[model samples]
Target: MAADDGVVLDEGAVVLEDAPPSNLDKLENSPPSNLDKFLKRFRALNPHFVRDDAEKLVCFFGDSDISHWKELPRVRITGDEGASWARCVNVGVGGAEMLHVAFYSAECRAKYRPDVVVLCAGENDLGAGAAPPTVFSYLEKSIAAFGHLDDATEQAQLRLRHDPQRTRDNANVVSSLPIDDTKSQQQDGMNASEFSRLRNNNTDEKVPIVYLCTKPEPVADAELRREYERYDGRIKELFQRYNSSCQEELLYFIDNSDLRDPSLYAQDGLHLSRQGYQVWDARVRDAVERVLLKMDERVLAP
Candidate 1:
């Protein structure tokens, strides 16, 4: 069994702020009423369907894992509790791959300008027999979509607004300090808060991509070990490379790979159970807080 507190990290904003209103209410107060109404109506009319940006603009992409996450709406909101939030619209299709995430165009990011993007994949890529180079190549293309310059016209409107005096100890800095460079390595020292600021702030840098890493699962079978060895290892390596390439640019990774519970799996020793989801949720909350803190430090820095 993984430690009882395996999911708990040393520093993170655990106390969630009041949950934001449903996406429907947010849309009620926005422009292009007709478009918003159409989206709301469509989601309301269909079962097992999800929608995005009813209030704020945000985009999410992955495969089945992310796609299913939409079904579980957040009861408690983490990160910058009161700042601003966006309803995630999963572009994930079950059994999708990294290449799918890269090759498949996400109109939402272009249209809504999300404050953050949650990317989860690779399992499917390995299942599909993707080579190591192919996997890394896909990630390279995907990250590049965020633009590759400190000052780019396409990403000029991004901003990192923060009220420094509000927090007691500038919680942002506390959350963003590098943890383990070897374990969660990346280019530059950009932590969670920095990524959040880049996404929310008015800057010329491309949209900050938060690379969410999958947790380590129990691999009792040789086949499972082989699968994990190829896909999981490649994903981590590729993320490190991306981080190194964009050290000064706006790019970062969130290591949730440490949030798994070995005992939560079934006899097959693969996949997360309900309890496992709880563990993953905690890590997600931490990443959100880190992003907020990074953004706050950048905006309020003296």
Candidate 2:
């Protein structure tokens, strides 16, 4: 009936002029025609930041799947007992991997300084046909980068406390450190020590890291499904490795792989419907409760 630009179309590639701009905008904005807009809307539903009524902060970071995280209406809060957090920011971007997370972490903490971050990634890494160790290696680097920032912040804070005037003079330089960049794209400059400090703080009281295993994915049997499955197994293995390296009380993992109901997915066997999102919402809440338990143990243990 109409060409994409709102010009009327006749059968043989002929287009009629005089189409209204109003009509043109609608056609141009159509979901199929404007994938960027659709993706933006989809990602926006997952806010990257939300004010926390409770003192503690929580956030989600990863790729598209995490971008859709806020679609889950409710979130579970630990330590508060009866309290709950509304929602935090969703920083997921399309095709983001652990390297992206590592890079973004340097950016995110510099900006928001959220106390808790919920990550749902590895999907993109696995989907890209990465080997297990290769993906985990990147993830390891990313985690280290996160700790690196924590170390910098701690050192800066300590220096400020020791000599407020001296710190004031040097604050610019300290803040200018590459770890302070919140712009996501600027973290490529981090070096090895910068990376190791991120993991070194595993048991540090100030900056505790929580890594959630990826959610369960549908077995779509697409051309890339087997490849995806291989990566999925790798993800679990990484979690196991991280958990084993430390006492369970220090580093904990909650398995929400089966949280979303199989029925909630779209027929394509890959994304989710609104109902499916609700299931994920519930899963994250439960997982948070578990994470809180671990945190409490770490804090309360003698």
Candidate 3:
């Protein structure tokens, strides 16, 4: 157990002594970054900026449910096969809780510059005996890490971006803009035109985060599932509040159907089976399609 740091969080939130250290030096040895290894592998896979038809990145992160999903790029983006499509990577760690995601939230965005991020965690947090309060704290931290903008400020930025005076001379600011899709995107070896697309004045996009609610699992009994459901509701309510603050149209959820369908689970009654992954993959791809397609419409619209 971690020693108390002598602090408490919000009403439902609690601070853990063993939580990932915020200091740069203490972090050299203490709690190790689990995502660091995985990110290295991903960066190596994508040696250079993807100038291929795959123009956008859609990242998926979570526990085994997300880690196990191995989807390829089959979803087409437009009539022109030459147009850019979505590239995806699953940065899930098998036993990760929302704490891991919260701690590494900024790095997650920096690495991929993903246009869309689908997050499916917290199941293991509940499974590992974390109470609803703990999960809420985890979620609050994760959402805040994304730098959620106040509605008024966000709207003001959007309005300003759309204003003719501001957008009419994108060429002028293009040379001066510090960051957009990401500082890393430019650093990743993309040229000037590539960086400019990220600042596309049309969407005012902010790498929307998609929230995937914890699904009912057969490994958990009815009572446990009920507890999971209750926790899910609370965490989802929290997610929606944060998601609502800065979200585009992105919801192709699996909880829409009978959640306990055994066909979805493998023989282990926990990890998803081939059929289950198919269902999840399709829904995720559909969500990605909607977001990208909408952005296309927004850009093309008069």
- True lDDT of residue 180, candidate 3: 26
Clashes of each: 18, 8, 0
Give the candidates in order of lDDT, highest first. Answer: 3, 2, 1
Candidate 2: tens digits of C-alpha lDDT, residues 31-129: 123234434443454354444444555567666666645454455565546665544566666445553454455556555566556665564544444
- Per-residue lDDT over 134-176 for candidate 3, one digit per residue giving the tens place of the 0 to 100 score: 4545654554444443322221111011122322121112112
Q: Please report how far candidate 3 places residue 260 from its true position, in Å.
A: 1.7
User: What are the per-residue Cα lDDT tens digits for candidate 1 across 72-100?
Assistant: 33323334446554355555554445544
Q: Model 3 clash pairs?
A: none
List candidate 1 stretches off by more than 4 Å: 1-58, 70-86, 105-108, 148-205, 214-220, 223-227, 230-250, 256-263, 266-270, 299-302
Q: Please report, in order, the local distance difference test score of every candidate based on alpha carbons.
A: 0.43, 0.45, 0.51
Better of 1 and 3 by TM-score: 3
RMSD of each: 15.7, 16.8, 14.6
Best of the candidates, lDDT: 3
For residue 105, what is the lDDT in candidate 2? 57
